[model samples]
Target: MHTIFGAGGAVADQLLPILLHSQQKVRLVSRTAKAIPGVESVAADATNYTQTLQAIKGSSVVYLLLGLPYDIRIWRAQWPVIMTNVINACKETGARLIFFDNVYMYGKVNGWMTEETAFNPCSKKGEVRAAIANQLLQEIKAGNLQAMIARCADFYGPIGFKTSVPNLLVIQNLIKGKKAQWLGSADQPHSITYVPDAARALYLLANKPEAFGQTWHLPTASELITGRQFAKEAAAVMQKPDGVSAIPGWMLSLIGLFNRPLKELKEMNYQSDSPYLFSSDKFNKAFGFTPTSYSDGIKETCLWAMESGK
Candidate 1:
């Protein structure tokens, strides 16, 4: 049996069909049950050890795909506790763990980032991520659990309605025939991972024993594109005439004064202000999987956004 914790989010939502198609016995655990056919949905809070243990019982593999809100205070208070509970539950249940992670732990980097890059978290949220990731690794080393970390860049694909960049700014704006907003530097090259590709890669990694106890960057498209380029391509795909414009940091800060999420975003502005590239060469070499090109990804994303908007 394979169990997915925090299964209501975009990544888990994308992963569900893939697992179902394989005829795997899958359990989806979250605060509320999701109404998907051919899967068992269990409502449980992962921060509670007893509930997590009950949710993960009889599972061969457990996916840690939980996501917290964009508040630093909540992250600081909840991440470690949730991680500890999950780790303990996995250890007790003898379920192998696969953690879905992002690139925030690496902080700002010069040139492309790889799995081997050092952790130099710049913000409080980044520090929380780094700490939790390191704790997972320590547990693995201590022979308490078998696990792998599958990390991805900022992602956008089908069913990604709440994704940060593409959904909120690019695809939505283009679908509405409005000018797209770009965060920070619109010209800096940024890496993005297609959600479906990430789902496929995570499934593959879970089945491979050799991938255990290691961190792997998921397959991302090889070519890097700037936000302006992405928006332009998306606009063309959606047949919109409006162009993309950058949202200055000062403007974001002014908006942040009243909006908590926007205020929290200011600490991570360094990522958008400079070029951020993520490398998945190791994953490609191991699995021989190529990611969907940005053009194709954008086209599919636009279609999903248009359909969902209806």
Candidate 2:
């Protein structure tokens, strides 16, 4: 049986269908329960050790896909506690673990990022991510738990309503017939992970014993495109003629004075200020799967956004 924490989130949403279709017995755990055909939904707070233990009992694999509030305070206080509970539960239950991770822990990378990159975190959130990731690695190194970390670049997809960057700014603006707004420099190249591709890659990694005890970057399109290019392509897919507008850092700082989330984004603006690339060569070589092209991904996402608004 496979149990997925944070089952209602975007990644989990994409992962569910694939797991069910494969005839796997699945349990979906979240703070609130929702009914899904062929799957069991359990209400459990993963931060609570007892609840998490109950949720993982009898499971063969546990996928940690939890998403906490995007606040430094919340992350600093809760991430470690949640990770500890999950690790202990997995250790006791004898379930293999697969953690869905992000590129934040890498901080500012000068070139393409691979699994071999050193963890030099530049921001507070990055520091927290680094610490949590290291904790997982330590458990694996000790032979206490079998685990793999599947990392991805910034994500955007059909179900990305609550995601940052593309959904909140670009797709939302396009749906309203307004120019897409990009943070920092729009001309710098950046890589984006398609959500369904990420979900599939994570599932694939879980089944491969050789993938354990290491980190794998999820499959991403080979082409690196600028934020401007991304927005223009999205507009073309949406059949909108209006172009994208690059929001200067000074303007974002001014707006951040009253907006807490925007204020928090100030520290990570370095990602957009320059080229950011995350390579998935290791995963591609091992799994032999191709990621969705950006053009196809943008078209599907825009269509979903438009239909979802209706």
Candidate 3:
């Protein structure tokens, strides 16, 4: 059985239904104790060593799906505790860990970032991520435990919440019958990973012995959508009211100075404003995993957002 942390979060919500259908026994852990039909639920603090160790014991694989709150300051307070606990838990139980991660560690990369991208984190959060990930990799290399990493790009899913860039900004516009807002230079090429595909990629890697001790980029639908084109497609999907305006990067950066979260996004202007892509050729050749098309995924997300009354 596998233990999925952050079970109440968006990614887990998207994953559980599919995972349950696969007939794999799962233990869901969250800050709040809630029941998922046909799955065990455990409420525990991820940063609490004893709680984490207790929850992790006897589980063959653990999904390190924990995410920090939106507050940058809180991340500083929390990530170390969580990583220390995770490392200790893995060491004690000899369980393999699959870390759910983002592309932040490959900070300021100029082209399609692959699994081989160097860790040159530029943001505070990126540094924390690099530290934790490298520490995990070191532990694995030391033969203390087994580990794998899956890095994803922007994401959207059915039970859409505040996790993805589009869901955070675009859904309101679609729902409000207004033109959606795009945060950066739309002309910059962007790759958005559907949340289901990200979850699937993580799950597929769980039992693959060859997958251990390395990192893999989640296969994502490749779309060369500039922020403008993406906004156009999203607007079409919702058929929203016209008069959409592009929110410029300078404005976002200006607002970032007052808002810590927005400020964190300033460093990522390179990604949101530049020609960035992700190459999944290696993963495809290795695992034969093909990502769902962006159009299909976007259409599904549209129907879901519209249905959710968001």
Candidate 4:
């Protein structure tokens, strides 16, 4: 049986049926247990070693998909501790660990980022991510157990929120018929991953033994569409007038005094307004995996927004 942490999140929720379809025995562990078909849910916390050990027992492969609080200060205190718990749990159970990560470890890089990109993080959040990644990598390097890390770009899909572009601005603004505000220049290139793409890449990594001790870029669409272009496209999908727009850095900072989420998002505004292209050639060449079409992902998101009761 495969053990997964953070099953309450959107990615896990979407991945549940897909993993079960393969007839693989699955255990879904989170702090809260909810009913999902074909998978067993357990209420367990990753931060607690005793609870984690119980949740992960008898599972051959364990997936770390946990997240910290939105506050950077809180994250700095929590992420490393969480990683320590996960590492110890793996050591106790001898389970292979698969970590779901993001591009933060690479920080800000010029040109496109590929599998070969090195870590040179700038922001506080990026540094924390780097620490967590190295902890898991070290375990593999030591031959204590097997490990694989999957890095994905900012992805969106149904039930996604808190930091999702569509949930944060696109849909909410469109519903109110108010212009949406964003962090950076709309003209910069940004490659977005569909949530399904993220889940599938992790699945491939778990199934393939060769993936251990190596990092893999999750599947992302080939296109590097700009923020403004995405906005216009979303409008087309929603059949709404152009309601997307940009919010300057100073305003974000000013609003940050009252809004913690926007404040946390402000540090990385440079990437949103600059080119943040992620290359997936490594994953495609390795697992023959290609990402879902971007238009289809966006179309579904728009439909979710339209039908949502608010």
- Please tell me which predicted candidate would have the highest lDDT against the true structure: 2
lDDT by residue for model 2 (1-310), tens: 9999998898999999989888999999999989988898999998899999999999999999999988899999999999999999999989999999998889999999999999999999999999999999999999999998889999899876676577767888888888898888889998999999999998898888888999999999989898888889888888887577888878878988998778788888888998899899999988888889999998888888888882
Which runs in model 1 stand beyond 4 Å of their true positions? none
Candidate 4: clashing residue pairs, number? 0
By summed lDDT, the worst window of 10 consecutive residues in model 2 runs over 160-169
Q: What's the lDDT for residue 227 in model 1? A: 95
Q: Backbone clashes per model, in order?
A: 0, 0, 2, 0
Each model's lDDT comes to: 0.89, 0.90, 0.80, 0.81
Per-residue lDDT tens digits for candidate 4, residues 1-310, read 8888988776776667768887889999989888777788899877688998899888899988876667899888878888888888888888989888888889898998887899888888999999888888888898988888888888777665665775567666766677655558877888888887788777778988888888888888988787677777778887778745788788889989999977888888767867899998899888887787778887887778788754
Candidate rank order under TM-score = 1, 2, 4, 3
lDDT of 3 by residue, 126-206 (tens): 887898888888888898888888888877767565778777677667777766776666567788888888777777888
- In candidate 4, the residue pairs with backbone N, CA or C atoms under 3 Å apart (3 or more residues apart, or in different chains) clash, namely none
lDDT against true structure, model 1: 0.89
Model 3, residue 182: distance off in Å is 1.1
10 residues in a row with least lDDT, candidate 4: 159-168
Which model, 1 or 4, shows the larger TM-score?
Answer: 1
Full candidate order by lDDT, most accurate first: 2, 1, 4, 3
Point out where model 2 deviates above 4 Å: none
Q: Write the per-residue lDDT of candidate 1 for residues 147-200, one digit (tens) a residue.
A: 989999988888655655767888877776789888899999999999889999
Q: Best by TM-score, which number?
A: 1
